[model samples]
Target: MKMLPSKNLLMTLLTAWIALFTSSYFFYWQITFSSQFTHVFVGCLMLLLIGFVYVKNDFVEFEMFNLKEK
Candidate 1:
């Protein structure tokens, strides 16, 4: 029923990009070590990056549901 905030949308896109790259790198490392630790590390890194961006940008709206829980 409503539109997403421009900055929030941009942040979401950037976060997705970050996650995509991180996942790719994780898979690459998985081939080398044949272990899941690196994947977990990459996941943690993605979470940290996303959390930092969200906190810094204050993207408090849910674009899909058009809800503001803040």
Candidate 2:
């Protein structure tokens, strides 16, 4: 199986790192997100995104077709 593309891998890691730092900051400070519901929603979405990216990177491979999607 072929590896994931470098550009896509960098982007995925970058997004996950930003999300991880942001969420960790909030959790570390024990901030109440009751008033900032949007942050909570975004955090949850980012969590799923991070998990998906991690799984895809580690366990999945994409089919290549002339260097682009088929």
Candidate 3:
């Protein structure tokens, strides 16, 4: 089987998209419920960190899911 072009780029883009979406959701949550900017910022940071860790650990598995070896 032939490999897809820019596989790494695709993986990176997916990871970034996940991270951004998660962090944005958390930020929105914080802003909706929290009155303080500090709290919202902290929540956003935490969510982003968590997303980064998740993506770092799972990206390889995710990439491998659709990849076929020749």
- Pick the lDDT winner: 3
In model 2, state the lDDT of residue 21.
93
For all predicted structures, in order, the TM-scores are 0.36, 0.37, 0.37
**Could you give the candidate ranking by TM-score, starting with the highest?**
3, 2, 1
Candidate 2 residue-wise lDDT, 1-70, digit = tens = 9876799899999999999999888776655667478778889999999999987876545434434665
Tens-digit lDDT string for candidate 3 (23-51): 98877663444467777889999999999
lDDT of each: 0.77, 0.80, 0.83
Give the least accurate 10-residue stretch of model 1, judged by summed lDDT.
61-70
RMSD of each: 11.8, 11.8, 12.9
* Model 1: per-residue Cα lDDT over 1-70, one tens digit each: 8976799899999999999999888766536563567778999999999999897666544453356433
Off by over 4 Å in 2: 1-5, 29-70
Ranking by lDDT: 3, 2, 1
TM-score of 1: 0.36
